[model samples]
Target: MRVTTFAAFRHRNYRLFFVGQLISMMGTWMQQTAIGWLIYQLTGSKLLLGTVQAIGGLPTFFLSTVGGAVADRFPKRAVLVLTQSVMMLAAFALGVLVSTGQIRVWQVAALTAMRGAVMAFDMPVRQAFVVDMVGRDDLMDAVGLNSSLVSGARIVGPAVAGLVMGRFGTAPCFYANAASFLAVIGGLVAMRLTPSPRMVSPESVLRHAVGGFVEVRRNPRVLGLMAILLTVGIFGWSYSVLLPVFARDVLGIAEQRYGLLLAANGVGALLGSLVIASLGDYPHWERLVTGGVFLFGVCLVLFSWTTRFHLALLFLALAGLGMISFHSTANTVIQTSVPDAVRGRVMGVWAMVFVGTHPLGSLLAGILAEHFGASLTVSMSASICVLVAVGVSLARKKGNGALRPNVTGSAGTAGQES
Candidate 1:
């Protein structure tokens, strides 16, 4: 519940990057909200909405590994700059199209696909670059604190987008998002993070990409973590994409109210992330992730059954708390578990699962909502998530001591007795 995790800010580069990232995140959220609202208005089809989300994830699913390769081969700073520029352009393009009345469902989906492709490279580089600013020792604190700012954006972006889109339509929101990129770009340009050498090397790019997969394949704990995250991403995270429908159709809420509802989730998420930031390293973080995932599913099931808006909001707060706690912990574990050299690729692989599957979930949920109902989609996804959590627990029990993983080549591998 602490507002700022300033202890991690002792590192000069981290402090600088944090401020810029905070600003950039707000714009990212703004664009996302505006895009969703626009898509809903234009197509009025939940299936298209789902397809837009699915298209955006295309790059993450396909290019993320190569994006990691790109992060590995090039200077992360340069890569970030390029990706951020691409994002800015894409946002601007969407805004122009909407403003000019040239936008259509296919256009939105195509643009979203372009942005997702850009994100495939952008996310892994950014996630990997955090360690460069803060180092591994304080990496968990840095990651936790970073989530606070992102959730903060979740707090502000939607509300702002809702108002802006209401007053000026979605175009201004898109323009604002495009313009927000300059903040991160400026922050990255100003940073003097020293370039570090690669931990693992191969003669060719394909070989290097394959090498990262091989290294990860050797580690069962990382696999376990990835599996858990995959479950959370596919199920626990689909609610947001479905929210517009809930706001418009189910909840009988207005445009700005959608933003307020999201802000409520952000409030819970921010609180949870700050709590993690305030903590020391959690040895039991694995169980925390698992428990959060399970709690998220439980909350979602109940939330789906609700007809009262205020009651649904209360359940959403609980779901948000579980979601952020799970995400912050999973990110910390992955960053800490992987070695530095292949960390970006490993993180990219993680993003591939965490972000890549979101579209599929959203698409299915939207289709279900269109045909069946939101409640059923929410309930079904949550039920599947519970099953996924159980499977994850069983996998962990089987792997413990039998096949531990240690990327650090240090003592006390995961699943081993200390």
Candidate 2:
């Protein structure tokens, strides 16, 4: 059977969720671009930029485990509603502060931290909820499409934010982001989902959290994937913290051109996501995951050294493509390998390593950039990622089978209703 990229769209709930998320995420990207630009404008300090990002991510690092447990114990949709509502309020508050010209660096940090805390609960639950919407059969397609949605927004949001900020300022971006939440909330309200059985453990939330860690430890495949994700998350993804620096200092570009650079990256990511979606039931996930990481690392290293605007954009686009390819495949592999009962908890652990470590990466990048300059710091970080990818590939060659896909055995049951 031919695999269609839109296979997941057959499910109504998934369609609603997808449409809502695409719209909302565009606003999210806008806000994210604005925040980074605003901070860079306000402080002009690389260290402060990284510091603020670190503060924002710290809450997810600490609390995502408990958030995962909450997801397993409650209805995922309801949890998302609450979390989304809080996030909307926080965005609006930031917009108000910015519009009134009373926005300080501390205020930005505080609001960012608030949103991060909400996302600790939001992200894992939202990830696990994909199965609830479309079940397991089209999970990979759904995952790929969802990634494309994010990347698609990434493409448009930064470009539009640049125009908006250049004309009206950053406040409008925040306000726009706050308003975007309504689409998602409405979609959640409109969905008619059959609630799956909850894994309501009699144990404490801490115990449930511990069980998640135990699950990762017991599954060597998951453990290996998590290790790679951690390495990439820390060194590879954190390079984004330096983009504003690269744009202003190295590329000598204004906001409009900077936005184009971001959009270039997004376009690459979107193409990568489409490739994944079109693969249907292809089984060579290990190849995609490892190759994608290697490509991303190489492109990032090249991008870090390039001062020419066009060359930098080309490298960043390739890096973005590699990034989403690895991310989407890894997520599919992990989700399929785990049981539904513990999916949320496992994803929570995933969030802890993947999202949580971002703060450390950002902070480290900032400190390094402040002393060594952004170009050298980014190159050094990307080089680490390259080394790690090569190591993983060599290890896989040794027939350890840790990174290989095992989708047909017990794992195949992951998509079935609980």
| TM-score of every model versus the real structure | 0.91, 0.96
Which structure among the candidates has the greatest lDDT? 2
Write model 1 residue lDDT over 47-156, tens digit each, in one string. Answer: 77777888888777887877777666777788888999998998999889989999988888888899889998888888878777765556678888998999898889
Q: What's the lDDT for candidate 1?
A: 0.77
**Tens-digit lDDT track of model 2 for 28-131:** 99999899999999999999999999999999999898888887788888898899899999999989999999999999999999988999999988998887
Lowest-sum lDDT 10-residue window in model 2: 409-418
For candidate 1, what is the TM-score?
0.91
Among all candidates shown, the one with the greatest TM-score:
2
lDDT of each: 0.77, 0.88
